[model samples]
Target: MKLGISSASVTERYGYDKGFELIKKSGFDAVDVGLEQYGVESDPFKLYHRSEDEFCTFFDTIRKLAEKWELEISQTHGRCNTYSMDKEHNAYVRWVSERDLKATSLLGAPACVIHAIVSGRFPEHYQNLEFMISKNAEMYGDLAPFAEKNNVKIAIETSGRAMVNGREIKGCFSDAPVFQKMFEAVDTRCKTVCVDTGHTNEAVPFGAPKVQELIRLLGKEITILHLHDNNGTYDQHLPPIRPSRGTVEWCEVFETLDEIGYSGVYNFELNLIQFGGVMDEAVRFLGKYLRYFIENKGKLM
Candidate 1:
C-alpha cells in the first residue's frame, strides 16, 4: 500500500499549487482531491459553480501539475446532506455531487467518496435504519449508471455517532450488519464502501465486533479508506500513531487489511489542527506512521 494524503489538509491555508507542492515535498505518492469547499478563483476543492469549459481547464492544469510532481489522484470526495429539510440546499448538494462524479472521472481517479447523510436532531428518516438503507440505495441507484459511464466508483463512507439539535443520533453506517445491509441494498457494481477508522472506533466502542470484525464483515467490498485516529469519543481526524494521540488499533487494522488482501492506497484523512499547518511536521508524522505500518503489516497472519 502506497502512502497518500488529502488536499483538504492544507488547501485552506495554501492555494492549490502550493498545497500540491507541499504534499509532494511531504513524501506522499498520491492525493485525495478535496471537493469540500470553495477556494478563491475556482479551486478544485470548491468546484460547484464552474462551467464545463472552466472545469476542463482547471482539471487539465491540475493534471499537468500532478504529473510534474509525480503524484496520482487517489480519489475525490463530494459533499451531500440527505438529512437536511431545506429543499434548495439538498438540490444544490445533489447538483454538486453529479458534477463531482464527472470531475473525478476527468482526473482519471478510480473512485470518489460520497458521505452518508445521517440524521440531525429530532429523528428524521435516519430514525428508521431500514429507511436510511433504502434511501441510500435509491440515491446511489440513481447515480450508479452515471458512475459506470464515467468509469469511476462511488465509495460510501461509514459515519460517526453525533449529538445534534439536542438529540443523540447514531451513525448510519456504524454497525457492521447495518453497513452490510446498506452496501448490499445499493446493488451496483460501481459502488463500494470507504471505511473511516475514526468513525469505526466511535461506532463499535467496547462492542462485540470491533474494527477488525467490521473489516471482516465488509471484506472485499472495501476498496478505499479514510484512515485517521480519534479519542474513541469523537471524529477528531488526528494523525494515526501512538495511543496517546488516539485510540485506533493500527496493528489490528494492518492485520485485517493483509487478511483481506487490500492493495489500495493507504490514505490518511488528518485535519490541519493536529500538525498546526506545518508541512515539515506533517511530513515527519507521516514518515513515522508509514514506517510503523510497514514494519507491522501482516505480522499477525
Candidate 2:
C-alpha cells in the first residue's frame, strides 16, 4: 500500500505548503487535501460559506506545493454535510462540488471525497433524504462531463451516524448496505467510495473483517482508504492500535489489502485535537507505526 497523510492533521500550524512539506518529510508518498475544512468557514455545524477567489488561491497553492515536493495529490475533500436543507445550501453544495472537482482535476488528483449526507435527521425526513440524493446526483451529473474532461473521480465518504426515531442511531450510515445503496444510486466510474476506517469503526460492528467485506462488496469501485484507527467508541483518529474483538486489526488490514489487490494510497487521517501540541511527535509515532507495517506487510501478505 502506498502511504499518505491527510492535510487536516496540520491545517492550523502549517497551512498548505508547510503541511505538504511535513507530510513529505514524514515519509508519506501522497497527501489528501481537506479542501472545505481548512481555508474556509465550512464547518459542519456552521453555515456553508466561502469565497470562490479564496478556494482558487488554495488550489493554486496546493498545486505548487505538490509540484515542489514531488508528492501526489491523492484526493480533495469537501464539507457537503455542512449545508442545511435549503435551496441556498443546496446551491452552495453544488458550487463547492463543482469547484472541488475542478481543483482536483487541475491538480491531477484521482478522487474527491465528500460526505453522503448529513447525519441527524436523514431517516426521519425520507423525502428530504431522497431529494438530497437525487439533487446530489443531478449536481454531480452536471460535473460528469467536466470530470471526464479533467479525469477526476468524486467519492462519497461513508458517514459515522445513523438516524432512527428522529435521532441518530449512533452508528448506522457507514454500513455496507447503506454504502451499497449510495453507490448503486450514484453509479458511475467517476463516482466512487472512500472508506474511512475511523468512520467504519463507529458505524460497523464487525471490525476489520467487515471492512474487508465492504471493500470486496464495493469491488473496484473502492478508490481510496482513510487509514485511521478508533477504539470502537468515538472516531478517535488515533494511530493503529492492537485490534480486539469487533475492532480492526492493522496487520490483517494490510493482509486484506494485499489479498484484494488494493494499490491506492492508505492515508493516515488523525485529528490534532487529541494529539495537542505534540503534532509532530504524534506524526513521528504514526510514521514509525506505518514503517513497521510496511516492513511487515510482505509477511502479512
Candidate 3:
C-alpha cells in the first residue's frame, strides 16, 4: 500500500499545487485533490459559480505539479453536499462531477469520490437512496466514455446519513448489499466503492467491523480508501493508531487489504489540526505505520 494525504485536511492553508507539493515533500506517495474548490478559501457549499475553463486550468496546473513532484494524483473528491439538495443543485453537482471525471482522466487518477444525498428530503430512506443512486447514474452516464477514454473510475462513497419515513437517519447504508444494488443498477465497470473508515465508524451503532466486512464484500471493487480513524461518536479525523472499542483495528485493516491484494493508496484523510500544527510529523507518523505494514505485507499474506 502507498501513503497519501487528502487535500481536505490542509485546504485552509494550501492551494491545489502547494497542497500536492507539501504532501509530496512530506514523504507521501500521492495526494487527493478536491477539484471543486481549487485555490479558493471558501467552502464549496458557499460557492455558486461554475466555470468550466477555470476548472480545466486548475486541473492542468495540478497535473503539471504532480509531474514535477513525482507524486501521483491518486484520486479527486468533488464537493460534498452539492448533490444532497434540489434539482438545480443536483444538476450542478453532476456537471461538476463530470468535469472532475474528465480532469481525473487527464491527471491519470483512477477514481473520483462523491457523496450520496441525504434521505430526509424524500418520503422514505431506502427510496431516497435508490432515487439518488439512479439519478446519479443517469446524470453522469455520458461521462462514462470520458472515464473509459481516460482510464478513470467513479467511486461513490458511503455517506453518514440515512432517511426513515421522511426523518433524517444518522447512519450509512446498512451494508454492502446496498452498494451492490447501486452498482448493479448502474451496470458500469466505472462505478466502484470508495470506503471511508471514519464514515463507516460513524454509520455503525457500536464498533466499525462492518468496514472490514464491506471491504471483504466489495474486495476488488473497492478502488479507493479514505484511511482515517474516529472514536466512534464523531469524526475525529485522527491518524491511524491503535484500534479501540469504538475505532477499527489499524493492523487488521492493512492485513485484510493485503489479503485482498488491494494496490491502491491508503489516503490519510485526517485533520491537520489533530496533528498539533506539524504536517511533517503527521506525514511521518502515517509513513512509519504504512512502511511497517508494507514491509510486513507479504508476511501477513
Candidate 4:
C-alpha cells in the first residue's frame, strides 16, 4: 500500500506550489486531494460552477503540481451530502456532484469520495433498512452515469456522524453487512467504498463491524481509504495514536488488508500537524512513524 495524506493543512499553510513539495518531502507516495469549496456568499460553488475551461484549469493546476512533486492523487473528497427540502437546492447538489466526478478525472484520481444518502432535506424515510437501501440504490443509479462519463468511480464513504434529529432517518449504511448489500445494489463499475477508520471506530460502539471485520466484508470492493485515529467515540481525525492505545488496531488493520489482498493507498484524512511541531519535520515524522508502527509494533509499544 502506498502511504498518503490529505493536502489540506499544508496547502492551507503554504498554498499548492509549496504544499505538494512539502508533502513529497514528507515521504508520502500520494494525497487525498480536497475538492471541497469554501467562501463567503454564493462563492462556495465557485469551482464547480466555473466555465468549462476554467474548471479544467483549476484541477489541471493541482494535477500538475502533484506531478511536479512526483506524487499520485489517490482520491478526492467531493460534496458530502445535500440539504434543504427545496428541489432546486437538491438539483444544485447534483450539479456539484457531477462536477466532482469531472474534477476527479481531471486530477487523475480514480475515485471521488461522496457520502451515502442521509437524513437531511431528503424526503426518503430511511428508518426502515429496506427503504434506506432502496433510496441509496436509486441515488447511486442516478449518479453512476455521471461517474461513467468522467471515467471515475464514486466512492461512498462510511459515516459515523450522528444525526441531529431524532425524528429524521435512523440509520445509514455504516454497518458492514448493510454496506455490502448496498454495494451489491449499486453499479459497481462506477461505484466503490472508501473505508474511514475514524468513522468506523465511531460506529463500532453502535453495533457496526470493527475495522478488521468491515475489511473482510467489503473485501475487494474497498477501493480507497481514510485513515485516522480517534478515541472510539467520534471522528476525531487525530494523528496515529500509539499502537494499542487508540480505537484502531494498526497491526490488525494491515493484517486484514493483507488477508483480503487490499492494494490501495494508505491515505490519511487527519490532522497530523495538529501538535504545532515544525511543519516539515512534523509531516515527515508522522509519515515515517505511521508506517513503522504498522510494520513493526515495537513489542506492542
Candidate 5:
C-alpha cells in the first residue's frame, strides 16, 4: 500500500499551504483533505452561503498546492448524517455532504469518507436494524449519482458504538454483518468501506469484528483506510502507538490486508508531526515499514 497522511495533521499548525507543503516534504505520497476545517457539519454549508466564491477559491488553492508538491489527495472527510429527525438540519447536513463530494472531486481524490450517522444516544431511533440499514442505503443512493459524476466513491467508515449517559447504545453499522447488509442495499459501484483502526479497536468488545477479521470479511470492498491508534475506549486519533502501547495487533492487521490482496494506501489519520519527531524521518520510516509489511506478508512484527 502507498503511504499517505491527512492534511488535518497540520491544518491548525500551518493552515493549508504550509500544512500541505509539510506533508509533501515529509515524504507522504497522498493526503486526506479534511473539509471539516471549514466547519464540522452545517457550518461548511454556512461558509459557502457566506461566500460561495471564497469557498471555491479555497479548494482551488489547495489543489494547486497539492500539484506543486506532487502529492495526491487520496480521500476527503466531512460530516453528514442520514438518521437525524430534524428536517431542516438534515437538509443543511446533506448540502454540506454534497459540497464534500465536490471538494473531493476538486482535489482529484477517488473517495470521500463518511459516517453511518446513527447515534447511540437515541435507542428509539435504531430499534430496528433494518430501518437503520435502509436509511443509510437510501441516503447513499441519493449521493451515489453525484459521486459517480465526480468520479468519486462514498467510503462508509466503521465507527465505535458508544455508551451515552450510562446507556450502551449501538452505533451505525458498527458491526460487519450490519455493514455488509448496508453495502448490499446500496449501489456498490459508487460506494466502499474505509476502516478506521482506532474505531475498530473500540468496537471489538461490543461484538464488532476485529480489524483484520473485518478486512478479511470485506476484502476488496474495503477500499480506503484511516490509520490511527486509541486506548480502546474512545476515538483518540493518536499517532500510531507502539505495537505494545495499545490494543491493536499491527502484525495481524497487516497479515489480513495481505491475505485479502488490499492494493490501496496506508493513510495515517493521526497527528503525524506534533507527536514529537523529525517529520521527514517519521514519514519515511512509516512508508518503509509499510512496504516491508506488504513485502513480508504474514510475518509477525
Candidate 6:
C-alpha cells in the first residue's frame, strides 16, 4: 500500500522533469503517468504526436527519472476522450491506447487505466450505458492481445456522472453491477477495474451502491485506484482528508482493502485547487496524512 499520485496536475504546472522532482520531494513512493487523458482536449496530447520510437523513448526516459529518485512507475492513464461526442475521435482514442500500452510497458508499469466512452448518442442513460458497454467490450476485446503482449493490463475505471449538454448524465461502468456485466461481456484477463473513489461517491445521490458495498462487490477485481474526494455530487477531486473532503466511509475503504489483500498503490488524483494554495507542500501533507491512517491499519481512523 504505497503512497502515489497522478502526474497530470503537477506536470501541467512544472513539466515532466520538475514535476517528477516535486513528486519525489512530496514523499511519494510511486506515480501514475498521466497521458494527458484528463480534462477536455480539443486535440490529442503532444506526446501522441511523437513518432512511435519517440513515444517509447519518452516513457523510457520518464521511467529512468523515476528510478533515479527511487520512485516506482506504478501505472498510467491511457488517453481517452470521455467528453467528446465525435464518434470519429473514438478511432484515434483506440490508436493512442495501444501506443500507451507500449509506453506503459516501457515505463515498467503493470497497468493502464483507460476510460470508457460516454456515448451520449441516446436520450436515456441506460441506452447510452448499453452502447458504451458494447463499445468497451469490442474495443477491449480487440486490444486484449496487445495489452498482454505489452505486459500491461488495461484497467476499466469506474465511471461517474458528468455534465453534458447542460444536464448530468451517468455513463457506463457507473457501478459495480455494470462492472460485472462488462466482465461477463468481455472474456479477457487483460482487463480489470480501477475504482475511482470520488466517482463512486458522486454516484451515491443516484442510489448507486455505497463505496464499501461496491468494494465488497468488486473485491479482488479491483487492481488499481483513482483516489480523491468530491462533495457527493460534483467531481471535485479534492484531497482525501478531513474538512468535509467527502472521502465518504474512509474507514471502510481501508478496512475493505485490507480484507481483500489489495497491495496496489493508494494513488491520489487531486485537482490541486482546494488546498488553499499550499501547492507542493499541500501534496506532501495529504500524502503524509493518508499514510498515517494506512500504516496504522485504520486504528487511527
lDDT of 2 by residue, 30-131 (tens): 888876754246455332244656656656777888889888888878655534457687666666666667778767788888776644534445434456
Q: Write the per-residue lDDT of candidate 5 for residues 1-301, one digit (tens) a residue.
A: 4777777756656777777777776567888888765545345346555576777777888889889988888899876354466677667767778888888887778899988766552456666778877777877887788888888899998867665556664465777777788888886587888988888887777777888887788888888999777777677776653553567767788878878888888887875655554654565566566455445642435
Give lDDT for model 1: 0.74
Q: What lDDT is reached at residue 52 by model 6? A: 73
Write the number of the candidate with greater TM-score, choosing between 2 and 6.
6
Winner on TM-score (1 vs 2):
1
Taken over the whole model, the C-alpha lDDT of each candidate is 0.74, 0.67, 0.67, 0.77, 0.74, 0.75
Mind giving the per-residue lDDT tens digits that candidate 3 earns over 1-301? 5778887666456665676666777678888876666423464632324465665665677788788989888898865654444778666666666666777876778888866444444444455566756755664464567666667887878655454675544543535676666666665667778888887776666322456777777788787888777776676777655444346565566777877879888787777766656865666566666556546742334
| Stretches > 4 Å off in candidate 6 | 37-45, 82-87, 119-125, 128-131, 162-166, 169-172, 245-247, 273-277, 296-301
TM-score ranking from best candidate downward? 4, 1, 6, 5, 2, 3
Q: What is the TM-score of each candidate against the true structure?
A: 0.88, 0.81, 0.80, 0.90, 0.86, 0.88
lDDT of 4 by residue, 60-143 (tens): 998999999999999998877653456776677677788788889999999999887764434445456677776677767777
**Model 2's TM-score against the true structure:** 0.81
Q: Point out the higher-scoring one by lDDT: 1 or 6.
A: 6
RMSD (Cα, Å) of candidate 5?
Answer: 3.1
Best TM-score among the predictions, by candidate number: 4
User: What lDDT score is found at residue 115 in candidate 6?
Assistant: 75
* Residue 199 displacement (Å), model 4: 0.7
Q: After superposition, how far is residue 232 of candidate 2 from its true place, in Å?
A: 1.8
| Residue 240 in candidate 1, Cα distance off native in Å | 2.0
Between prediction 1 and prediction 3, the one with superior lDDT is 1
Top-lDDT structure, candidate number: 4
Error of 1 at 262 (Å): 0.5
Which residue window of length 10 is worst by lDDT in model 6?
Answer: 36-45
